[model samples]
Target: MAQRLLLRRFLASVISRKPPQGRWAPLISRALQTPPHSPGDLTVTSSQARPLYTTRVCSTTFNIQDGPPDFQDRVVNSETPVVVDFHAQWCGPCKILGPRLEKVVAKQHGKVVRAKVDIDDHTDLAIEYEVSAVPTVLAIKNGDVVDKFVGIKDEDPLEAFMKKLIA
Candidate 1:
């Protein structure tokens, strides 16, 4: 009796939906038509199997290396608004926020430039800015920090703040 009940439920489920026929027909036909290749036919070597790091996008290549000796001259003295991201390598929130900040920079490519400062590497700069968090984004205009955000922030608010500052 239990087996019959299970079979009836299975039949109902099968009848309720159209079976995938046309979409899977070609794949099923191909699998039946092709003969399986032998191991010897495959020529992939260990070196070929493991691909080297290539085609790195500009965004992924971003790293927080030692800042220029005249960091202030480059960032604070810039004509356009400079958005400095103070982050550390070990911080999980920083990792997540880093890519989002990059998108914000790409969105405002000409109007603003983004720079990263590793608090672990440049402790002085972090101390100078009074940054006490992992992911802190500071918008600097005319060498003064006009706006700052700690932790993950919505893109709209950040964009609006930047637009107002730029205007």
Candidate 2:
């Protein structure tokens, strides 16, 4: 009798066709895929391998994927000062410097942005930028190279250098 009553109640609820309410509503809607979800599909596939430092492939924080045109568009033409890090995968100093530079850049907030260029991926850009070394950093402002350093600088010196660029 209780089972029958429960079945009848469930049938009545389904027949009413009213929208789900409260906490479980979202889970149910998501499971059914009946209602539209905004922000599109936020799913990452196994085939897509993101970097260890960043979650998304295209991140806005410090590491940027700037090709020839993107480099100009985002770094060179920007109102804010830009620090272009020219590096390679096999470089030891670059691996060390990349994170350290990012930490300092984060302290500056919106004042500065870092664009990383993989020399192996974009050999043309490396040659154009005249990056003979693995860890070459360039500071750009007003569409020109204002300052630059070609080595793995410690946190203090790098921070000081960054300050000079923004100042």
Which residue pairs clash in candidate 1?
A: none
Please give, for residues 37-145, the per-residue lDDT of candidate 2 as tens digits.
Answer: 3576343222332323334343335544657888778887889898899988999999999999988988886688888888998888889889898899999998899
Backbone collision count in every prediction?
A: 0, 0
- Per-residue error for 39 in candidate 2, Å, reads 39
Name the runs in model 1 displaced over 4 angstroms. 1-68
**Tens-digit lDDT string for candidate 1 (1-167):** 34533443444343323443677756544422324457655332223222224453444123446565556766778797788889988999888888777776777756777778898888988899999987998888889989888998767776786686677
Best by lDDT: 2
Q: Model 2, residue 25: displacement in angstroms?
A: 12
For model 1, the run of ten residues with the poorest summed lDDT: 43-52
Candidate 2's C-alpha lDDT? Answer: 0.76
